[model samples]
Target chain A: MNELLERGPEIPAGTWDHDWISSVVAKAEEYSGRPSHWNGKLYEQPGDVAGVCLPDGSMTISRKHVLDQARPAYTPGETLTSDQQFAAAEATRMAVFQARHSMSEVGDDSLPGATPLESLEDIALENARCDQFSREYSGRIAESMTDQSLPLVAQAPLFPAYSAATDRLLYTLGGPTGLSHRRLGELIDSTERTQRLNAIADEALDHEVGELVPESHRAELREHLTGPLRRGLGGLTMTEMSELTHPGSKHSWGWDSAEWTEVEFSTNLGDIKAHYESWEAEHPGEEPPELPDSLRETFRDREEEIQQVWASKGWPAQQPVVGREQAYYERLPDHGPVTARDQEIAKLQQFLWSHTAPSQHTDSAVDTGGRPDNVRQIGSARKHGRGVE
Target chain B: MDAYREVQRLYAEAMMSAASGDELVAELGETVQRIGDLLPQTAPGERASVLLMNSSLAERLARLPKETR
Candidate 1:
């Protein structure tokens, strides 16, 4: 059973002891012989629920309404009413035994906005919490109907793991075998990740160069590169910007056409900035490290000149993700196994994806200082997978 | 304090993701397939791993509002 969904959102863990349990157990004896209002069963068997403790020290088991909605139609191999449903299905039931233990703290109704202890004792208590749970359960059902509980890849994008990789790559970029300092070109993808990135990178670069933002306005771009985003994105250059902003590009891919969902198009600069701000809030105090002169040039004087040259040049939109993945894997025999050097980066990628942040080129938004447009939906060519950078 | 929690965490870890790096990677692949089968079902909005993976992401999620965030 997925405890997360079963419990609604996660509640922070807390302290509870046997002595406390014993006191509750004693109070709960009152319900041993009684039948719950909903179920005909006696309340002798109390469930092992982590009760929400009130300030007065009495513990309360958070109640969830037992509804068919909370049960997903397909749970690996069964339905709701089956004897085989997860034991956590007990979660929907009013665990009356535990309620009795929690009922004692409310001697008088002085706690403002708090429910009375007597009401807490009753298995049939109804109020806002219960109503909220009902709504949440319905939303859960609707969500399941839409987002199949998982993605094919559980891995994260490049990160602190990729940080070491990015740094080494940066060191070598002046030489060969690295992503060209020039905006290397084209975008193609039947999948969301690759297409989104290429579109973001190319679009943002073009958008920045086209619109003439004055020098002072470009300071943020320099700083943005060195921020927490730099952990995966590396230094601030048009090349680094495009590559780092390629959020989903680091992921593995599936080649056959039928399996992919083509996501096409782009939005303006303001929307892109909003996306960056949201992700930035996700990482506090993680400003990027000081830029070496090479990388910092994007942040320095003549920002206009740099943006202009890249904007004027051509950039590849992107290509197939599978071929890319295969290329990276092919290098494994010669370059060693496929492990990321910095685990923090792997963790960061997973964090971004799980949060459903825009997986494409918004990392470029900070470059132009928040002025842009959506990706152009062109014919999908499809490309990207390991070792392309 | 750290040692106690570490012991508790490791015990749970042993039962959770596989102990060996290769085993864990293999498990991730299998998990991905299983999740893929769930196609169209939204996993929880937040990955529980964020909470487990050092508190940085978790703290961020906590600080943000459910909607505006």
Candidate 2:
């Protein structure tokens, strides 16, 4: 069974105002034990349903008296005794009464001192206006509905800002080939990290970008991206960035489609880190390894820009390695002849580095803006190989 | 309910006709579809008022057994 079906469908909490609908659905689900369906069309939303299917595959409407004339109808599926039907009906009736009573108490009185008939007319007028509004803003309404369940990081008015901030940081540090893990550690101290984030947030607020990242949502977007969502970004790499930007590519990571929780992403990166650490111990060398045949094939498959990225990043011009298990090459680096272990290590460190704020304890020589002799061993991308500036 | 279905069919036909590049026809179709969507909320009878008054009741009744109603 679909997990959403198991619990019954719901308008995600904090996003919708239709609690009455949720309660009614819950009550119906209680007696039915599962959602109503017709020929496999799941009746997830009450508004979409016309009637319920009986065990014998027939349909039925609701009773009068139980549901007074003013109230809408429900169509519970299969084997609902009159009593169960009554119970469901009674629940709906009570829910309606409560919702109406609450609204009368708190709802805006657009026409003060208006008689009951006038109020009804006003409601009809409002309904028409709302229908017109829906027609005008149908696309936005649909986008909003689709986006409601998504995390703030993944949703609009935030995703673009998040993407822009990340790209800016990466570009500021280095070009296509980002800073090596060791160099990244030295450049961004805790204070600088804090300042950079604050600046990004401020920039987002100051700039009046229309729908790309709305001004109204920018403040909240900044708070979230700089807060919980910030750490999740640590796991991103050049390959991941490529995937994020080219959402339609075959290599596309389907993070947007699914509920990608921060814990799951961090745990995934942690597992990769642990595996790469073990591999690093076994294969301990800085020089780019012999080119893997799969990497060469992947190079061919990529566009001209990616090919240039590979060529400039010190990949061997010829003599590619072959006959290895394809699975072994699955984690191979996008550029350079570096072993999968090296790329994995860099990816893991990148995630960790992004997650952490500047360290309080720093190497005096490294922090003094002076490069240590050992730092030369693990050099920056530009220093390691001749590449396009 | 039968009227609602008829309206829906008419609305769908209007939409299909409008797709053939007539602006006035397209507008007419859009109006028809909007009326069809709002039928359950605005029909003259009490049953039509169900979703507009209490959406939950509409949802529940839509899924419940006929129970000889």
Candidate 3:
């Protein structure tokens, strides 16, 4: 009967039969005796036997009431009336158990039995393999998305196992010939390594240029260079500025003037100075005007020459020189004495004023230093002038 | 051991039987057809067959020629 039931389909619902329920209830009764409240209390109701609760609202009981009320043959499988359903469900459950056991025995030769720990280990290993596969697959997918060739170093993590997989793939797909896979891989790896090093060097340079350079020097260098350096300055120090500014120093750094001249039209100071000196030397015969003191001496000599010439020519002269005397006055470096010229002009004006009106003696003769008699006669005439008047 | 060998043999067979095509639409149809062939509804179980179908499809796709894929 077990074989027959086991071979049939599994029961689809859960229910039980009345006979099974009654038998289970009888077993329960046999074990516990008549239903009663297990707890002992002093105020007991008339119909409350030990622990069992009566169906009427008047009686109270213990947990025995709940247990007694349960139908015992409730199993899981078929749906039907209690008696028929319980039988079918019980049969189905027994059939399922037997079927599992028989099938296990039949397949025992093929199945590998493992302890729980061994099963866990196997699962862990499988999970690891799956993770590795997933990682490789994802890496490949990422690599394929771009057409541009990645630097060999950047491509390393994407193809962890093989060194030249990318290059090999490229070569296989009608790439340049005369390129071995190993050589190509090495080339790419070296190229990418170089690129990475260069990038690192660039970043370091930026930091040095931006932060390490002193503010004053940086501003000066900026003005000198006119802009940022295109080729890096190779970590030059401030002390190198002396070498940089020297006339023919190899260490001197600057833009190529010849190259930049087309854009910058201003004449350089060096060129201007050179041209000025060359012009002066070319016209050596032409001298700049003499210093102011030398000019004053020359003017005085010219004045004497003019006076002698005027006397020899008998040109009517307005004033005669009493004496010729050299004059000296201290002056600032660029300007001559202001007070001395003012004093000289005042003396001339006073002399003119004294000579303009004749005294009471009406003598027209000029004062030549040789004429003392003439001066005496004029004096006498002045004394006798009142009587004649 | 026999069940393991059978599983491996069936997997390899399914992988070998997968179709190849030049067009994406054709390849997709071939993939579906191969999966359906490897996983018939009449099989006693569904889980193992479904797994086998998926794995076989993946293997076939991987082995496909670049131009065809």
The TM-score, computed over Cα atoms with residue i paired to residue i, of candidate 3 is: 0.13
| Model 3 alpha-carbon miss at residue A256, Å | 79
The numbered model that scores best in TM-score is 1
lDDT score, candidate 1, position A368: 47
- Predicted candidate 3 versus true structure: per-residue lDDT over A209-247, tens digit per residue: 333333333332222121111111110111011211221
- Sort candidate 3 into its docking category: incorrect
DockQ of each: 0.03, 0.03, 0.01
- By summed lDDT, the worst window of 10 consecutive residues in model 2 chain A runs over A316-325
Per-candidate clashes, comma-separated: 51, 15, 15
Model 1 vs truth, CA RMSD? 23.3
Residue-level error in angstroms, candidate 2, position A218: 11
Candidate 3 ranges with C-alpha deviation above 4 Å: A1-128, A131-389, B1-10, B14-32, B38-49, B62-66
Per-residue accuracy of model 1 over A1-389 as CA lDDT, tens digit each: 21211223322234222222332233333323221122111111111222332232433333222122223422345434433232222222122223332332223334322222212111111111122222223223223332323221222211221222222322332122123422211111111221222222334434533233333433433233212122122111111112222323321111111011111011123333444444456754444232234333322222223222322322111111111111211122223343342232233323223222222333442224232212211222322211111
In candidate 2, position B28 carries an lDDT of: 42
Ranking by TM-score: 1, 2, 3
TM-score of chain B of 2: 0.33
